[model samples]
Target: MGSTILPTGMVFASEQNITENSSYSSSDNVGVSIQKDENGDLMVVKTETKARANVARWGAWQYTHIALSTGVTAGAINTAYSKGIGSVLGIFGLPGWAIGNLLTAAGWTNYGNSPGNAVARLWDKNHNGWVGFYKRTGYDGAGRAVATAYKTE
Candidate 1:
């Protein structure tokens, strides 16, 4: 496949042997699409925002790096929020724990919504040096979060 940047700034990947009658569909939430132009060229359109675009396009490498650095299995890390740990603060005793748990319950109404965030948190805590590299490579905390989300998704 090949990629082209549309005038509207959407990045599209293309396949060969497409005809004018070819159909199109988005491959993922990041907006990858396969389309046929008037000239009958088949294309995969990627209209993901900057962060999601990277993850959708280059997730394999990024996720592997996160896994190596965090020393925690991706499956385990992805389920951290659901295992009742991220849901509780528990520092100020019972009342604090109650408030923390309440917020956690509210936040997790839809569990496992974003596994990347959990992995990102672990990376942020355990891999400070790599986090710096990620920043230099244009990944802020939110970008890293999206990267993690992309991995899980």
Candidate 2:
């Protein structure tokens, strides 16, 4: 576990693999401490945020596509969401997409959602014809967006 000091004197682990902003998810069991009295009395405040209850974060976004009509590319997904396919399969919305386009998954916390219905494809190094946007339902500790890529139209 890694650690950092926030301006308010809070602490967090670097293990979240998040940078550019300091943050932790609700699902992450983190604690913040406050001095109850100047005499050194202290209390621990725990914060937690779980992913959507209906879908498991680990089973949300796994995909590697060759193109529409063809099918999933063989090695794409394993290389993409390396966190494990089962953990990413259905976290976004449906089970699958049209036969042509493919969903691309990356580090969920790496990029921020673009402004106003913008498809964040520009930030994706492996970007294809990514287009057609959806509400970015995910965020990191800094409240930066972690959008879901559901189409490439």
In candidate 2, where is summed lDDT lowest over 10 consecutive residues? 97-106
**What C-alpha lDDT does candidate 2 achieve relative to the native structure?**
0.27
- What lDDT tens digits, residue by residue, belong to model 2 across residues 26-137? 2332332111212221112222223222212211323433232111232323222343333433432332321101222122223333121122332232445332222113
- Residue 83, candidate 2: Cα error in Å is 31
- Enumerate residue pairs that collide in model 1: 13-44, 33-45, 116-148, 116-149
RMSD each, Å: 17.0, 18.3
Error of 1 at 110 (Å): 39
Which ranges of candidate 1 are over 4 A from the true structure? 1-22, 27-29, 50-153
Model 1, span 16-35: residue lDDT tens: 33345753333322343344
Candidate 2 stretches with Cα past 4 Å from truth are 1-17, 20-23, 27-119, 131-153
Please report, as a residue range, the 10-residue window in candidate 1 with the lowest summed lDDT: 129-138
